[model samples]
Target: MTASPPAHDPEPPARRRGRPPRTESAGTRDRILAAAREEFSARGYEKTSVRGIAKAAGVDSALVHHYFGTKEQVFEAAIEVAFAPALNAPEAVAEGSPDAVGERLTRFVLGIWENPTTRTPLLAIVRSAVNNDTAAAVFRRLVAAQLLRRIAAQLELPDAELRAELAAAQLVGCAMLRYVIKVEPLASADLEQIIARVAPVVQGHLTAP
Candidate 1:
């Protein structure tokens, strides 16, 4: 009888697409997130693609999808990192005496834009959000929905959420004009000068009777 054909080790399980070994998985996922941020930063939400992010990360496009699913999800994941500092706004508001809540919040928000390292990605996200509804939704969810809700909860004002949103709008508009649009004296003004001029207005919104 012919010798039975030797088993071929089941073809090594076909290597299972995008399934890095457990130890490698975290690194791989982090790489994809980093790539996603770069891509979204460069291309904006409308133009960025999963394939481009995958190429940047040196992985298959399937792997990006595997980690983050849809392009919007990837955009959301990417901006979450850039917006992380802003996420602390509520805590900053809550920690200070209510008398200076506005200054604390203003300083916190502007401080984020003042730093070159944090400013770049935020500028990208702001541009994306300004131009794209999907990106705007993500921005609102991360900033308005989260930060405003917490500030409102902390302040307990009759119009606390509204006040929080107004405060956010003030800072956001200032940031856009200064950082993203680079408009005139505001952009050129001293960081402390901007903080002093803007903080009282922000405080007024939050603590007005």
Candidate 2:
């Protein structure tokens, strides 16, 4: 038998294994997420692609699909990264009186975008939503599923759901105009001034008759 092919030379060290060493799957997932965020932010949701994200992330397109399954899933992940900190706003709002809830909510929401750490992602989401319907749908789902419903649950009003949704729309709209679209005067105005003018309106939507 030809000496059994020289006894296979003990299969050698490199060829002994059937597959490469397993890596930390979570690391790859996180890297994909980071890359997705950058791609989405830079190209917007409509223009971003799995291949582009994978190339930017230094991975295979199959890897992005393996981690997120679909472009929508990737968008959802990016939104989560963008909105994670703001997720705590409902809890903060729950701690205060109904009368003060509007101001508190305003401050909390606006404060997030005012900070550079949070502002970048928030602006990215805003810009993408404005330019792409797919991004807008994702944003709506996020606000409805996380922010609006949670805050509505804390309210004792009859029209809590509608009111909460309206408030969310107002907040998001203001952010779009002031920050994303950069509408003059509103965009250049001080944070405190905008809060003072808009908080009462939001509060009214929530607590008014």
Candidate 3:
């Protein structure tokens, strides 16, 4: 009857051209996160903004908000990505000889900081955490939920949580001084030398008699 009303209206070219490729995809979300990291690294938490992140990412500000919700949420996401490798530290403990778990854990974490790709994002995250309360909260949650608690589980010891925190403090302090503060000797020191010295303290924290 009227050619069945042409079945359906032709899709609008403008709408099709401007539409997001999909509702959400890993690739787009990652790009937003990577851009946010660069922005935070360059500007710090207090100075960085969603519009800047979106611009750096070549997307609308709305897209950044769509993917990450808010600037604090974006920081959390970025921290999560940067620390993803370090989260596997529990495995380093689980797979190693009980006595040597400290070195395994230390080596695993320092190795992440040693890589330029991972370190850049970490620098941004740590700097943000130091300067912003919200960033610090995000960092703490990510560390506690994804890393320290799991390592504690593997210890099977009293005060496992405290042990995990102490071990974390040892490694994290070293990382901050070497990577972020750039203290001369520590910054210039060889990775193995640092690990060799720090690993024992980490071991004591986790498994001292």
TM-score against truth, every candidate: 0.86, 0.81, 0.86
- Judged by whole-model lDDT over C-alpha atoms, candidate 2 comes out at 0.79
Maximum-lDDT candidate: 3
| Clash tally for model 2 | 0
- Tell me the TM-score of model 2: 0.81
Q: Residue 85 in model 1: shift from native, Å? A: 1.4
Would you list the clashing residue pairs of candidate 3?
A: none
Better of 1 and 3 by TM-score: 1
For residues 62-129, write the lDDT of model 3, one tens digit per residue. Answer: 66666678788888888888888887788888995898998999999899898889888888878888
Off by over 4 Å in 1: 1-23
Candidate 1 lDDT, tens digit per residue, 17-91? Answer: 445366566677788888888888888888989879978988777666666889999888878888888888888
User: For model 3, what is the error of residue 86's alpha carbon versus the real structure, in angstroms, after optimal superposition?
Assistant: 1.2
lDDT, candidate 3, at 33: 88
Q: Looking at model 1, report the run of 10 residues with the lowest lDDT sum.
A: 1-10
lDDT of 2 by residue, 1-209 (tens): 01111222433222235552346455666777888888887888888998898788776676666558789889889899889988998897899687988988888998887787788777778778888888899888887889888999998789899998888778888887887788999989999999998899889988899
Q: What is the lDDT of residue 39 in candidate 1?
A: 84
lDDT score for candidate 1 against the true structure: 0.81
* RMSD of candidate 3 to true structure, Å: 7.3
What TM-score does candidate 3 get on C-alpha atoms? 0.86
Clashing pairs in 1: none
Clashes of each: 0, 0, 0
